[model samples]
Target: MIAQKAGGEATLLPTPAILERLETKRAIEGDRTVSGVVQRARGAAAYLYSAGVADTSSVHVDSGYLTPDDMRSLVEKGAVGDVIGRYITAEGTIADPELDARTLGLGLDELRDAAMSILVIGGEAKHPIAHAIVQHGLCSVLVTDEHTARSLLDAAPDSTTSGEDPS
Candidate 1:
């Protein structure tokens, strides 16, 4: 499970507090693994190490604010040897590892084909962004507050009862 921040002028980064809140919500909703990218590389490294999953590597994209030393500390802590430090142009797009891998010339589709789940936290303005992510097949599920969920559900196509077709 990898976490990537939502890109925009708002500077969205899933901090430890946000992750904790999301985890708690997931637990209540009967989910096990829930995580997201953090602003600090050290945080990302810590998260990956704590997860204890084999063959899994965590990435912390360069935010341009953190220094190479900071990134090195994160790497020393066990973040994946591969680190991404570049600007993504898409505003509402979720960071897909596959896309990241492609940009680095890795020539591997493991990250690209990997199934990713994103947790989006925001109000109405973020709805379209979330929708766009879903449309792009980047996120499998979206975890949001009740209000946002209601709004999305309301906007979604209505379904009829089984065996009853609405013509």
Candidate 2:
């Protein structure tokens, strides 16, 4: 694994195990059972993530690209953003946005909560999503091609220049 190559041990959280851990709660029957399952699974994932994040000194995330619309649809279930939805899980499976809430992946909040989120992404086609990620402060460190970096800076809102008066 990449962690081994980097001289670190990888902490693997298998999705099946995560779901299995919540299976008992999901055994309850009701009209809202499926929704409840989604909530429980999400909560379980969050708990595991919190434990991992809290114990770690740093985190390295290799995030994938989804158009802002796709990301919103996946995360918000079409309540906002584009109504049409497509999802790509962190494990790289393309799945129905509505049915794949249980897909194993890191949420935006989880990424931001990490002590360090080093985002690695680039490509002309990815510029928009990359820009959105940076604009939203999702990444504390970014590794990308020079062109993409320049584009990010160009699109950024103007701020006071270093060693200059704000007045």
Evaluated with lDDT, which candidate comes out highest? Answer: 2
Best by TM-score: 2
For candidate 1, lDDT tens digit of each residue in 44-161? 2111111101011223323333345544553344332221222121232223333232232111222223354343444654454444334444444566777767776676566665
Once fitted onto the true fold, the runs of candidate 2 whose alpha carbons sit more than 4 angstroms away are: 12-100, 160-167
Clashing pairs in 1: 3-37, 98-112
Query: TM-score, each model?
Result: 0.32, 0.47
User: Could you tell me how far off, in angstroms, the CA of residue 151 lies in candidate 2 after the best superposition?
Assistant: 0.8
lDDT digits (tens) for residues 11-115 of candidate 2: 433223112223332342222644554445445322211111101121211122233344444434312111011132322233343333333334555555656
Cα RMSD (angstroms) for every candidate in the order listed: 16.5, 11.8
Q: How good is model 1 by TM-score? A: 0.32
Name the Cα RMSD for model 2: 11.8
